[model samples]
Target: MPLVLFVDMDYYYAACEELRHPEAVGKPMIVGTGDTAAKMSGVVESCNYEARKLDIRSAMPVAQALRINPDIIYIPADHDYYDRMSGRLMEILKAFGYRMEVISIDEAAVDLDSMSYEQGLVQGKRIKEEIRKTLRLPCTVGIADGKVLAKIVCDSAKPDGLKLVERKDIVQFLSEKSADKIPGVGKKTAEKLEAIGIKTIGDIAKSDLVSLSSAVGSFGFELFQIANGIDESRIVEHYETLSVGRERTLDATKDVQKIYLLLDELSEEVYREITKNGFRFRTVTAKARYSDFTDKIKSKTLGYWTDSPEILKQTAKALIRELIEEKPIRKVGVRVSSLEMGNKQMKLF
Candidate 1:
C-alpha cells in the first residue's frame, strides 16, 4: 500500500513571470505571445486565471487571445528560467524522501508510501509554503492512494489549493464529477461513453466491464479501474522517457549537405545528453518540419544499445535520405530513445 502525491503548479508561466516581476502582481498575464508583424501567428503558452477568464489560453492563437483581451500582458516563453526553478524545486522534494516522477514541466507525482497521509499532508503544505516564500511560485498539492486519484485531486485543487483523497473517499468524490475528470477520458471518449449511457464516473464504475472493454479495447478496462479507484501504477525511480531530442529552427537553406551538417551537430548534442545521464538507447530518430509546419519522424532501432554520436548520425542520415516527402525544411531534430541504464548489467526473475 502506497500513498501518491501530485504537485501541480498554477499557471506556471504566469507564476514564473510574477516571481521575476513583482510589478506583474494582480495583473492579467499571458505567456508565449509575441508582438510580431506576422498576423494570426504565435501561440499562448500559459495564462493567469484572470487572463483565462477572458478566454486567453495556452496554444491558442495569439490573435484570438487578443480579441478576448487586447490588454492581456504577453511574454515569450522562458524555458531556461522555468528549468532552473524546477530543478531547485525537485531538489527540495527529493530531500523529503519522495521518489519523484515528473509528469510534465509543471507537474509531478511523488510516492510517499512509508509516510502517513496526515504527515504527508503536513509535508506537502510545508513544501508549498517553502516554494511560495523562497521561489515566489504558487502550486497545488493532492494526495491519494494512487497516481490517477492523486491527479484528479490535484486537478480539483487548482489555483493554489490542497486536498487529499483517501481510498474510502474515492467513490464519493468522483460520484458527482464529469466523466472527463478521469484521466484518458477526453471529449471524444466521453461522447462515445455517453452513447453507451456512461456520463459520470459512477456510471463508468458500474457499467458492464465486458461491454466497455469491447468498445475501447484494453484502454476501456484501464479507464474502468480509474473510475473505481483501482489504480496500481507506481512512481518509478527512473523516468521511462520514450525519446530524448534536440531541435533547431534553422535559417532557410536549400543545400541538403548543410542541412545534414546541422543534423549531425544536433545528433551529437542529443547523444551527449543521453550519455551524460548514464543511459544507452536502441532507437535513433530524426524529425524534419517543413516551412509549412508539416513534419515527419523516421526512426530505427539497432540490435544493441548505443550512446555514440557516430552511430546516431549514421542512422539519422539514412532516415533523412528517405524523407523526400517534405517541402523546404524549417526545423530539424535528432532523437534517441528506448533508453536503459548502461551499467545495470544484471538479470532478475
Candidate 2:
C-alpha cells in the first residue's frame, strides 16, 4: 500500500481576496460567481468562515448572501492568478519526489511509500509549512495510507492544520465520523443511509455486505470498504484528458431556442476534438447548472459510435430536454466520453 499526502486550501478564493485587501481580514468576504454582484444570476463562489456564519456560503446567490451579510466585500475569481501560485508550489513538491499527482487545481495526492514513517511525516510538514511561507496562503495537509483516507484526514485538518493517520488510528478516525463525511457520499445517499439506521461510518463499517449492497447499489459496497479504512487506488502522475467543453452562465431569460443553439455550438466543438483524434464515443453527457446552483448530469448512449457533429448535437439536444428545468439556467456543458478506436476488424490474411 502507498502512503499518500493530501493538501487542501481553506476558503481558497476568500483567502486570495484577503491577501490583496488586508482590511477584508476578520470581515465577511465572498467571491462573486460571475461578473455581476446583483440578482440571483450571480452566486457566491467562495466566502470566509465569517461570511459563512452569517448564512453566506459558496454557491449561494449573491443577492441572498447580501441579505445575510450586507458588509461583505465581493471579489472576482482569477483562476490564472491561482494557477501561477499553484505552479510555484508544485515546483517545490517536485524537488521532494516524483510520485505526485495534482488531483485538482488546489489539491494534490503525493505518494511517500518509499520513505520511513518519520521521514514521511517530516516531508509532509515541510510541504505544508513551505506553501504557507512561500505563497502566503493557508493549506491543510494530511498523511495516510491511500488517497481517500488522506483526503478525509485533510478535510478534518482545515485552515493550515496537519494530521497524520497511522494504520492504528485509521479505524478510530473513520468510525467516529458521519457517513456523509466520507468523500463521495452526498446528501441524497446520506439521507438514505440514515433511514436504515446507519448514520455514522462505524455503523456502515459494521453493516452486513449483503444488506449494504441491497440498500445503495455498488456505492454501498465502496462505502463499506472506505469505512473499514481500505483504499487501493494509486496516484497516477498523469491521468488522461477526459474531455474539453465550455459552459456559459446564462442570465435568467425565457429563450429556450437560444439555449438550444448554444448547446449545438458546444457539441460542435466536442465533435471537432473527437474527429481530430480519430476517437469515437459511446456516451454523450450533458450537464445543467440551474440559476440556484443546483446541477444535474444526464447521458445518452448511442446505438453506433460516431464522431459526427450533427449527431452529437442531436443527442445533446435530447439530453438537455430531459434534464432541463423550467427555471432559469445558469450554466450548460456537453462532454463526450467512453471513447476508443471506431472498430476492430480481425481477418485471416
Task: Pick the lDDT winner.
Answer: 1
| lDDT scores in order | 0.77, 0.77
Off by over 4 Å in 1: 13-26, 32-39, 76-96, 129-136, 206-220, 241-273, 281-305, 313-349
**Tens-place lDDT digits, model 2, residues 159-268:** 77888888778989999899988887899888888878899999999997887877788888888888898987788764122343546557754477877888988788
Task: Compute the lDDT of residue 20 as modeled in candidate 2.
Answer: 89
Q: How big is the positional error of residue 24 in model 2, measured in Å on the Cα after superposition? A: 1.4
TM-score of each: 0.75, 0.69
**lDDT (tens digit, per residue) of candidate 1 on 1-349:** 4788888889988888877776667877777743333325778888888887776678888778888878776676655466557656665676776667767657888888877878978978988897787777899999898888899999998979989987898988987788889877788888888888888888888887887877666878878888888888888655344356777778765568978999999888777766766778898878776766656889898998877778889999899777745377776877777776676565332
Best by TM-score: 1
RMSD value for candidate 2:
7.6
Q: Report the C-alpha displacement of residue 203, candidate 1, in angstroms.
A: 3.0
Candidate 2 regions with alpha-carbon error over 4 angstroms? 36-40, 239-349
Against the true structure, candidate 1 reaches a TM-score of 0.75
